[model samples]
Target: MTEDASPRALITGGSRGIGRALAAAFAADGYDLVLVARNEERLEAVARELECGYGVDVTTVSADLTDPDALEEVYERATAGGAVDVLVNNAAVAVYGPVAETDLEAERDQVRLNVAAPVELTKRFLPAMLERDSGHVVTVASTAGMRPGPFLAGYHASKAYLISFSEGLTEELRGTGVDATVVCPGPVLTGIHERSGRGSRWLERRFMRSPDAVAADSYEGIRAGKAVVVPGLRFRLLPWVSRLLPRPLSRRLARLIIDRGDPLESDR
Candidate 1:
């Protein structure tokens, strides 16, 4: 495909936060969008907003990706458009407590949504991208994936799996024009914190970037076919800093920084 060709981007979790910003950014860049999320009302609202604001075609699919049955449907829904020029694997769930104290079903949902769903989606969509020899797959992993998270263990592990999977796929498609880029962003101002029963206020004070900033960086990196893009300076420094510290020290530091009290208790 040429530069002028109108690309189509499929983004998971596109109703709000980083996913919504990515969708809007892609629409502004002249890419048609297929936005997937579980909330139908919110998704439709975003679709209308993007269509009216950017003059682009916006499709919305409402499905819970945590269920295996829904995963099959989500895969089909994802590739419904003729050709997906870009795939943004951004749908994820997070649990913020000690592993033993966390609910088992919630942990399973994290694995299903964050790990299995993306892997399956890539397997389904990447073949056509490889054949076409001109497409990009961007997985929104996290800097937390660099090490074992003391509190958010399941979420961290899932992201680490996603990063590893993306890296391996990039190597596999090295010669092919199909590129895979992994984005390791630290906490951004997203609904994730609100949903995880946590808050972004502390992170906001420290190094939390806006969804718009993260989205912009992601678009450029994916377009340039960069292997990995870390959005902000502080977040970019995290993985390296974690590497330099002793394993136990690193875990302790992570716990201290990530220890957000019950998000539901906020004065909303």
Candidate 2:
């Protein structure tokens, strides 16, 4: 398609990491971009870079999804130009350490961003897509969602919610010219883990794949119409393999991985 005629994609958390990488992938394939993030400066920079490199239209909307009003603002600003052909619910947050010790409100905000934001955004965008009889919704869940996540209990549960959220949509949207894909990536070499306060250099180097790798895989899978995508080969199989083991042992294994190779606690 021509530049102006190209489809548009709105990606939450598109200022950096997987979101940005996915933006690049879509732009390369001739899609315009609407990027959402909290940092205005960062969002603009990515928009500029993508526009300069790909010659596609790029718009930036800075909003924290945890806020109740943010979704309305995003819907208004994002759809202003035209219909969003693809909505990537890629923004999310997590709290490390024990749940009781972690701030309750912060955990709640995580739920809002991880769960509510996507649900609301989907509600807003999917209708337009359905009316047009075309669109895609891609949500980035995590491999942690497939199993137990200990130190990151809130994060783990939130991802599980996303997995189910996307899958339910998948079944509902079939044959409607609209599709949904859920991306379940393992530890990715991004600021999300560090921002979560895990901040493990070993986790960065040892257990993680680059966000670009995941983004590329995600884009290809999405194009080929795959319903579920796990970015890495090892991470793809880990979830199902863990299921064969007992529940307690599976939880411990998940804990060990999330701990980024730290010593494990005595099994409860």
Task: Name the candidate that leads on TM-score.
Answer: 2
Per-residue error for 215 in candidate 2, Å, reads 0.7
lDDT of each: 0.83, 0.86
Worst 10 residues of 2 by lDDT: 259-268
What lDDT does model 2 reach? 0.86
User: How many pairs of residues in model 1 come into backbone collision?
Assistant: 1
Candidate maximizing lDDT: 2
Q: Per-residue lDDT tens digits of candidate 1, residues 1-268?
A: 4566578998999998889989988999899998889999999999999999999988888999887787678667666656888889999989877777888998888998999889888888888898898888989998878987777788888989988999999899898988999998876767575677755455444666778898898777877889998886657777788779899987887787667743522211
Residues 48-121, model 2: lDDT tens digits: 99999999999899999999898999999988888899999999887887766888898889999998999999
TM-score of each: 0.92, 0.93
